[model samples]
Target chain A: MMRLITSGAGALLGGLMMLAGVTGPAAAQGTGSATLDAVKTRGQVLCGMSGSVPGFSLPDSQGVMRGLDADTCRAVTAAALGDAAKVKFVATTTQNRFTALQSGEVDMLSRSTTWTLGREGNLGLMFAWVNYYDGTGFLVKKSSGVKAAKEMDGATICVQPGTSTELAINDYYRLNKMKFTPILIQDQAEIQGAFLSGRCDAYSTDASALATFRFSQGPKADELLLLPDIISKEPLGAVVRKGDDKWFDVVRWTFAAMITAEEKGITQANVESFLTSTDPDIRRLLGIEGDMGKALGLDNKWAFNVIKAVGNLGEMWDRNITPMGVPRGINNLWTKGGLQYAPPLR
Target chain B: MADTHADPRMSSARSSPKRSMSFAWSDPAFRAIVWQVLIVGVVVGVIWYLISNTANNLAARRIATGFGFMDRIAGIPIGESMIPYNPAEHTYGRALLIGVLNTLKVAVIGVVLATLLGTVIGIGRLSKNWLVAKITAFYVETIRDIPLLLQLLFWYTLLQGLPSPKQALRIGDAVFLTNRGLKLPLLVWEWQHTMVLATLAVGLVGVFLWSKHAKQRQDATGVRPATWPIGCGLLIALPAIVGIVLGAPLEIELPVLRGFNFQGGLTISPEYFALLLGLVVYTAGYIAEIVRSGIEAVARGQWEAAGALGLRSGMVLRLIVLPQALRVIIPPMTSQYLNLTKNSSLAVAIGFQDIVSIANTTLNQTGQAIEGIAVIMAVYLTISLSISLFMNWYNAHIALVER
Candidate 1:
């Protein structure tokens, strides 16, 4: 009883002295390793996607998910469940995406999300692979006569907050010793609305997103100009809750298979025909001659299913992004002078 | 025979030994104690279970549970703040502090403006002019019916639809109204200005003491003296004279149209303006109803008596109705003020970085959900308690004492 009383009094004094200080170090934790078995048992994988960004993760008029980011989700589903259709897409906002993943609301997030060290360190989430190489850029009306970002000093830039886009602009302005007004908004639609109405001088976001926005929402494609300058490096990718090494490996290898398929000249149409090829790499990747799937505790046909569902990386890009005026540029395979490199299938 | 007379009750008690074993079930006090213990035990057990579960989840996720992250540098830029803050230099703790100050800035100014506006509308509702009362009623009905969030969105959208800075609507050269915000001339601060402000505070205290002394004299002599003009002279005129003597330290900084926007004056971002306007306008609707009821609650006989003593209608209101009405108005008005303070958290919806909004960003950036939520709660709790304590004191001071 005396010990309890003393401890209670000590807590009161400690609370008073450091009302702002919380005791103990932060635990950078993630979901349990049971996610792999859980997803298999549930019979469907829950995939998180940004519901509004065009060419990335928007639903069609028929309510079917279709985008470059959406293809990643399908690939994951195909690898895990052996059926691309065995997936549910949950729309997520920038503010609540991490929370959704952490709370087990979604199995994986493939929302054209940027991979950042801060998120990796503290968010208890791991990036599976960089599916898109993006960078922060500015979008302004061509008629505004703002040719470059440096010329945009003293301009009001509208950005959706709670994203890396906000911090990138701040750093750019501060480093240039320039002053720019930031109009922070929560919704991407609202930011576009504000920018379209001339409330903001320019809209700042990822270069690919800017292209999608301009093509989908602008009055005319020629009226808006995406500036030549790329201010911040933004490698957009897929993310999963941390601590599930098997689940992470499943997603990671599925991504690698898509890239490897692209490298090996395999498309969704030709994947079945390639099964008879004598190439050892093709045989190993197609699971005709290796225990790669068994090592990850999956069936031998996992990589083959992923390739058939989403095609190769190049095919996915051509289907979703190429038509939207976003070139593969740096996102092409390393053999094609780009950054998308996959390890040997063996 | 005497022993037999005493033995009947004892004999019955002895005969019912089985009943004695279950005495707690029959005894009301004992049964009440048992019920209380059971309820308390269940509540404690549930709470313990929840805490342990949360701790387990945090440990499993590797998300640390602590306030240590407050010291980390906050890299996100705040558009504006009442305190000095640099995104690259200040810690998350400082950023949150600035957020708290911003919330207070809106709430304090909002409460004052809402009260003044509400008092006028309440009196206007009681006006003899038919148009005045009808318009006031329409305002109260329309504003109170719509949700505050919708009102905030409407105001923000409307502000965003205004002309660009280069083509801003201006009143003279000192003020500009544009989509960016309201640009007003700022008072350029110098070191001497603080001294002048301090003198003004002292003068205000002096006036208060003087008024108290006058009240005492009036009670002793049965003769009241005019204190309002003297009080104003000491509080305002004296400060002005001293300020001028100190070389007129307050200087005006006028806003000028710069390349893409205005520069040199105070810029009230549209987000802050919209949030302040929404909170004040919505709260004033409820406050007006409270004020009207409080005024009506005053006894009609008191007004009649004041008029019977040859007082004018205005004087009767001031001397008989208002003092009494204030007693009823204050308690409910305190609640309206509290509601306004709490409602200011909606600043997040409009992109105004209030404490709740900034802490949310901090938590998302750091992924310290427990710490972030605890900080936000502590801030609101402190604000709520302070307001309540002050209001309770004011209520007690004004309460009637029939000794």
Candidate 2:
């Protein structure tokens, strides 16, 4: 009778402790991110993306997700699961992206999400790394004979709601002493359709997205004119839920490895030759002379696997963005006078 | 045999008398009370546990909770508003107020329109003309069967297929129809207009008093005084005379094709238009059937009795049959009204920016999903309850009064 009572008491205490651990104070203060363990067990990354975006994360003819954002997911998957193909893309809208991440529906959001103060501070999520630097662009018909956005006062513009671009356009018009009516639509396809149907005078979104849209139009691309105004800074990047510092580091370092490889003139075709190079930095990055991957709880050749799977950041951009007619102007590396700069892997 | 022959009162008292409650298992009442208490306790405990779990989970995620976000600046630009709104100058609370107003705007107009159309169609369905009856029946059946969202999308698509602003269909240069929406010249309001309108209002009060006096005089004298002459003078001629004497301003501002689109006119956006049209058309179908059933529910003898008393068909319906049918109509009518109001929430799907849409955007922007959802639920509950209370009062007013 005594042993039975003691065992029952022990079981009850263990259950209560488990419950407490699950609901502990800040996720950052928890033991570690359960995301890593979940990812390992699932053997796949549930990557959130705007699946309709042409150059960001659209599905190709073979039903394979393709774009710069898709490549970002693949790079992380290679680091996390040792195989870039072990990823499932989840189509998420602007309104549900944060919720999906918060609810643990998606492990990482590689959608073309703008990095802003409101998103980081207000939402309990963090941007891991900037993969592309873009800006809000306005697309209008060439027949309008309007040269600048200033000249197009009192224009009816089509824009998506709950976007930084919407806020930027409002601010832009207020500052320029002009007026506009924005027909807010949540779906990008609908907004584009509304624009094409002449429900609005112009369509506005990210510059890269507009470029892709125009390119996809083929012969009709000449009929549309992309305005020269960079209304808002849109630094699109990958996002991860907070309270998992270890998982956050894994994502951050994954992008850094690709960028560092780009900075070192390492191409996917030539990475195998550099695996035996005597360069100390390259050796450390590829896990030849150091245990950098051990900190992230990954294989020593995790960076090597990532490069072999998706290549460096430049190669990813060339494969996805170049076809969309988007120039790698400000998205190039620091040596090329662009914005992307990687911290030392060490 | 002698003990069984005891009096009825004595037997009742001996078998089951009123006594103080006991905790014994044999005491049925006490056992029943204990079981009920235990069940209620368990239910309350479960609710408490669930609430605590949610609170703990929210805390663990570090999600901000509360209504303090309402005071922050809302940068969402609304397309159409009945009141003044500037995203830069407005708070989230004010934006949400505008959303509520937009919802009311649609619901009020949609309710009035649906009732009018439904009643007409319901009466038409009972008409002697075969064409009229069949057409109304067809309309009711077809519209009632399709989903409201699809109907809304169809109307929106049809509106989008219209010409652009540059090539809009123009009528007399004062009205323009385009994919953007219909633009109509607005008559600028002035003090003189208000003066004329006030005189009309006073005339209405005069008519009301005159009609009451006329009814009372007829009751006393057994002879009715004519009222239409006075009504015509008060309701119609007086307002016309007031407008002429005051010279109410009649200036009209036409929509001009400015830089890229129409400017300086009352514009009806396709989103709002399609939403209203869909809601009114779909709800009228259900309401028409309710009216049909209500009229059918009235006994056929009421009509024949009035006819036998030498009353015309229209007068028979107005005097006896319709008033009786109203008791049945009103209860179901209230349900249709509530349904119309609730259906307006689907405006989010069509970009109408009703309360649900604005609240959704607000929540998404602020990252306070739980608080935002709570506000939505509370707003809807309050609105639905108020509607129910008012309809219940109206229903009671029309209900049969039993002596």
Cα lDDT listed for each candidate: 0.83, 0.83
Q: Which digits, one per residue and each the tens of the lDDT, describe model 1 over residues A132-249? A: 9999999998878889899988898888767898889989988998877777666677678889878789999999999998999555878999999999999998998777787899
Q: After superposing candidate 2 on the true structure, give the runs of residues whose Cα lies further than 4 Å from its correct spot.
A: A1-31, B1-18, B25-28, B39-43, B218-221, B240-247
Candidate 1, position B393, lDDT: 98
**How many clashing residue pairs appear in each of the predictions shown?**
9, 0
- Give each model a TM-score: 0.89, 0.91
Cα error, candidate 2, residue A107 (Å)? 1.5
Q: Provide the global lDDT of candidate 1 against the true structure.
A: 0.83
lDDT of 1 at B143: 100
Which regions of candidate 1 fall more than 4 Å away from where they truly are? A1-33, B1-38
Q: Model 2 in CAPRI terms: which quality?
A: acceptable
Q: After superposition, how far is residue A329 of candidate 2 from its true place, in Å?
A: 0.6
TM-score of chain B, per candidate? 0.90, 0.90
